[model samples]
Target: MAYQTFRQEYLQVPPVTRAYTTACVLTTAAVQLELITPFQLYFNPELIFKHFQVWRLITNYLFFGPVGFNFLFNMIFLYRYCRMLEEGSFRGRTADFVFMFLFGGLLMTLFGLFVNLVFLGQAFTIMLVYVWSRRNPYVRMNFFGLLIFQAPFLPWVLMGFSLLLGNSIIVDLLGIAVGHIYFFLEDVFPNQPGGGKLLRTPSVLKAIFDTPEDDPNYNLLPEERPGGFAWGEGVSWNC
Candidate 1:
């Protein structure tokens, strides 16, 4: 009965977010078990191009180091915000959420090349938080039960906390930058007088991932309005 209950809860997670969190956990587990070395997964341009270790490009974004404080912290934020965005803002729009992942990853990878950084998982998490915060601007949020702020300032708050941890602010800044770019293109610019949607999801992906609106079982909930940006209405997430 206990196992069945656990299975039921596990099955309740949305698909994209579930797969992502599972990958992060399994990747870290592989490291903790000594099945793989962190060195092998980190981004190295020479190894990627010359040695043809193409897997590093994607692996680098998967592992957040062995199980510890940083790993646990990042995983929690990643899973929470990613799931929220997927089930809330990106609900029924699976293709667009996947596109956001691809877009953020590509931008982070390109920046990683120049910044000499490895393991962009945290930055990716920051990007997700940023995008979600922007879309739900009127929402209120509490940080660590101390600082209270609106949704948009969440990214900067994380960055400030990172600074206090003696960690480099580069990663957080990169994430905020990338997230702003996505928000600008997808939400902001598209609404401008002359602008149009720049980040169009391909029809192939839409056909495969998107849920059909005409389906009889599709229950359009009020919380899922405007891609789940029902700000100042839903319960706030304390980050």
Candidate 2:
């Protein structure tokens, strides 16, 4: 019964969010258990180019350091905002969400080459939060029940909090920059006069991740009875 309840809750999460959160958890657990080392997962362009350790490109965004305060903090933000975005504006649009991931990852990887940053998981989480917050500007958010602000200010608020924690704001800034670029191109600029859509979800991706809309037999919900009553309603149960 306990396992069944867990499964029900887990299955309630959208597919992309579930997979991303699971990956982050497993990666952190692996580090905690000494099954993997941070050096092997961090972003190192020299090793990536010389030793051909290309996995660093992807793994760098999976581990948020050993499980602790920072790791837990980042994981919470990542899971919450990612799930909200998936279930909100991006609902039933899996392909576009996947495209956003790929686009952001590519841009971050390119920037990581120039910076001395190692793990980018935190920055990636910030990017997710930034995008979602911008898309839902009017939504009110409270930060640890301390500071309350509109949705769009959440990322900046987090960056400020990181500064207070004595952590460098570089990673957070990188995330904000990349996120703004994506938002400007995908959501903002496209709506301006003489502007057009710059990001397009490919046909192949749509075919794979998006459900078809032309299913003739598809029923979203069961049909109701012809009248506002159920069959045999008049024949009440006899005690």
Candidate 3:
């Protein structure tokens, strides 16, 4: 029901999102006035997470680019993809964005930080996962008029491109972590859907995997066939 939820959430777009857009504009203006740097809270997790920090929950999304054209283009993309997601779920999905972005991003960030502090530099982990998302597993990306791998390729593509060429997205691990965690707990957390913990993880993973029509990752949608929802057909949050 990912797609159905998407439709519901889309109808309920959050007010905070618009406020965020305004805040982004205001921040840019402030920076232009030499009041503060654009990257002010890019790395200060504690400061970013403090109370009244609602903006922090959504700021990273505000950082389009400094240039007019690029920023506009990115905004269009954000509107297209993100808005589709928001609209797909209904009107309230924007709130879910805040939840997912914060929850998921934070989880990934914590994992990366933990890995670095407790283990080793594993930036490639994030990079690789992203690179792989550009395919719809069933369809291809429409690149310059040519349909490439698959539409589901977006998540990995965006992830990989960001890690490799976008920026040294060490901070992004935070975003990624929160995302998967939310995916894990979203509909069936605290209370197991499969009745008990015996199949909790797999069942939850399967739920996230199975999607309705308008899911963000097209590839994650259920296959085209006469049948009921199949858990194994969708993307399972592995690692």
* TM-score winner between candidates 1 and 3: 1
How many steric overlaps are in each model, in order?
0, 0, 52
TM-score of 3: 0.48
- The reply for model 3, stretches above 4 Å from the true place, is 1-16, 45-61, 68-74, 90-98, 105-140, 163-166, 169-177, 187-239
Over 186-206, each residue of candidate 2 has an lDDT whose tens digit, in order, gives 887878999999999888988
What's the residue-level lDDT of 107 in candidate 3?
50
**Per-prediction TM-score, please?**
0.93, 0.87, 0.48
Report how far residue 50 has shifted in candidate 2, in Å.
Answer: 2.6
Poorest 10 consecutive residues of model 2 by lDDT? 224-233
| lDDT per model vs. reference | 0.87, 0.83, 0.42
Q: Could you tell me which 10 consecutive residues in candidate 1 have the lowest summed lDDT?
A: 224-233
On TM-score, the candidate that comes out on top is 1
Question: Between prediction 1 and prediction 2, which has the larger TM-score?
Answer: 1
Clashing residue pairs in candidate 2 (N, C-alpha, C atoms within 3 angstroms): none
Model 3: per-residue Cα lDDT over 59-78, one tens digit each? 44345546475455444444
